[model samples]
Target: MKTKKHTILKKSVLIIVTFLILLSLLGQTDLGNFSSQDNSEFNYVTIQKNTIRYLQKGQGKDILLIHGSPGSIEDWNKIIDSLSVDYRVTAFDRLGHGYSSDYEYSHHIEDNAILTNQIIKQFNLKSPLIVGHSYGGSTAAFMAVNDNNSDQKYIILDSPLYEIKMQPIYMTTTLPVLGKGFSLLFSYTISDMFIENGLNDILVSIDTNQRNTIIKQRQHIWSQPKVIFNKSMETKNYNSDLKQISNRYPNLKSHFTIVTTKDTLKTFRKDCEKFHKEIPNSSLIYLENTGHYIQIERPWAVLNIIRQKMEGQPSSYKKQ
Candidate 1:
């Protein structure tokens, strides 16, 4: 049995190595060739000791884009150019997502926000505009409400699960049965395919060939032992202090929300609505013909809406 297992491991490693070689040979590792009508480009930024991947593009007023669970920075690739035209745009892979190494302490959003705040401060980004999607949206909200006297505008994009309901992924990450491997082969492949299909469904703009290339690259890169180990250790303890943060939303600076007409919005709609109602300056826009991934689904529309808000227009946020 031991010898057989050893042989299987060797084969797995060999396959991963071959896949990497092919990706390099075919130049399939890039974020994809977005249109050149946009002059700006995304450049990866590394924060030491994080083992994470981030992209910061353009040079102007800052806008940080945060992606959801199990997603990478490419989630915002569709809108980076549009948003970056006026605001410096930054996007990053959350821990356990994509090239970002799942660290021992990054399973939840508190540490993620702290690290991100540090990144902002380190880079000296003046008065950043934060845009968070799903889980990333929650982090940006918490960060905004808690960062007293900070100059950050928050754009929450379809964030659902919060500390109040505590998304069940927390428990699953800690499960003993499935904890041996961060994911079983069946679940792994299923989740991978789910993401690929989700992107196609929501982001109808990306070309099929480039999308396939990115999906294949993701599969090959995650075929490693380190990711599994990190996932195992990342299951315990998250933001126990989100209530206090949520309570202080009225004090946050420049809050905007995208309430996409997607099923995921049902999870925390009551909470988000209550927060928006109480927060004096917060605006929530309902995208009429889009889903949870509205930023990707209608990048141009979101960009225009954000620009209108930034330009201090008398905007109508609700759908007619």
Candidate 2:
């Protein structure tokens, strides 16, 4: 009788697992073809089992453009045309964000940094310039400091989460029973709040219609069980390791971090200011009246700043 009961429990677990998988597939279906609507103003390539939609254009020095959270390659589309003229700029949606494939876990900066390094190697591209915005900025900084041989200069524009670091609330929740419950909550409800509320908070300036469109897409990315599971696991901050990196930077001196047109209340802009001050020979561009999304808001200005960083060209950008 005991053996029969054990067999029943095993069968029940299998059935539950099968249901969960079907639900995941169902969620994907709900997202529909979130791709076709986007005309490939920029081209794309695949990695792993997923597609990495990106715009690769121009020549000269290779530049890898990284977008912020919950954004796709299109986020850089507004500036791609100008950036591509001088440098070979390649910008893509990070894993699990847009059209890119999801990671085993929704890996954060370190995972994305490693992924970028791999892509750089796979394409046989040079160490190239690394330009990142928002979370992408953080990832680019990680790669720049960590990459021993990448011939890369770093451009950080209005990075929202710089190092005003705080431990993620989820880490505390993930402790023993609390953690497992948090895992469940994050995998389900908490992700919804992040999508619904968090997007609104950041893109507060977006008009009603445009904001609604993003919110719809945001909701879709969050609802996926796999994505929620992956992101929830990424609640830790590895910025402390960055201090060691900064100390090694002058030797790793091929990088430049340009903090353009400072956004005072906009998340981590001040941290960029702090970092800019700390690093020797690094200059900060505190452009007046500039917001967090400076690259999209002002492409020529951003490109000019980048040019100065990469080529040591004369810059029209003045000190803040």
Candidate 3:
């Protein structure tokens, strides 16, 4: 009886492994050409052995825009044009996102900060105001805290500063042997549906053109198995990374302009409040009814806040 049970367990394990292998193979078929955006319009430069793509326009004060996880430089599409008119706006695709080249090893928020600082140095940007959203916000904060330069200014938008509870998909994709297969399979099946739902959930309104552009940008996230896999690793590591960086927050020299939506998740709102209190010279602004993607929902308000910050005036706005 014991021998029979052992044989059955072995067969079940083999069957599962075989299924996973097959699933991975099937999922690989869909890995066709994927471009997050029209790379032709952007400028490319090599930094730290990685080819980075960035967009720079307007000519005044320097402003660096950092996007969130699974996002690209296109995340700033609505606000970049307006911002570039007044400031030299620079936006880029972080490693493994959009058209940026991916590396074999996992890159964290610290790496992002390092890469962005290099961009500032390489481009000769002097004392640029860094604006970051979500994960990008964390990256911006990381850059600000570690830098000795007191001139660096940062605006953090609804970013997670504490540990995050991993989502089911994230958990599945981080698993050992089967993770790659599962993520690949997920990409081929329900990935786009999830992306669409998430976009709808975040944005107040989405026209045909806006929807199409966003969908294309998001598609790059799941277009390759490794990309999705790296994303999952990022989600898994984010909380621990944030914890490590928390001690340095109090030492940050830059004034943080934290903008959060009233309708954002309770956890994120709480974090934003806590972060504002913890940091020395920080101001918190609450926008009503706007979802997580506040810039897209209310770009004008963001612009007003930037202007106010630059002019050293208090920016208070009524919810629209």
Winning model by TM-score? 3
Clashes of 1: 0
Q: Which ranges of candidate 2 are over 4 A from the true structure?
A: 1-51, 105-108, 148-151, 160-200, 203-232, 238-251, 315-320
Which one wins by lDDT: 1 or 2? 2
**What TM-score should be assigned to candidate 3?**
0.86
Give the lDDT of residue 165 in candidate 1: 47
TM-score of 1: 0.68
Q: Estimate each model's TM-score.
A: 0.68, 0.69, 0.86
| Model 3: worst 10 consecutive residues (lDDT sum) | 27-36
Between candidates 1 and 3, the lDDT winner: 3
Clashing pairs in 3: none
lDDT values of the candidates? 0.59, 0.62, 0.78
Runs with alpha carbons beyond 4 Å of true place in candidate 1:
1-48, 161-172, 176-189, 193-244, 250-254, 262-268, 314-320
Candidate 1 lDDT at 145 equals: 65
- Tens digits of per-residue lDDT, candidate 3, 1-320, equal 99999999999999998898886675444353243455467877877777777899999988889998877777788888988888888998888666676654465888888888889899999788889998899888777767745666678888888766778878888887666677787777777787777777677555779767776667755456655766788898898889888878877767889999877553267778888988888899998767788787778888888877766688666433
Q: lDDT, candidate 1, residue 101?
A: 47
Evaluate model 1: give its lDDT. Answer: 0.59
Residues 224-297 of candidate 2 have per-residue lDDT tens digits of 54344334444344345345355655554544666655446554666677667655545667665545666655
lDDT measured at residue 317 in model 2 versus the true structure, 0 to 100: 74
lDDT of 2 at 213: 72
Candidate 1 residue-wise lDDT, 3-84, digit = tens? 9999999999999887645533433212221211122343344565555566776777777777765456767777787777
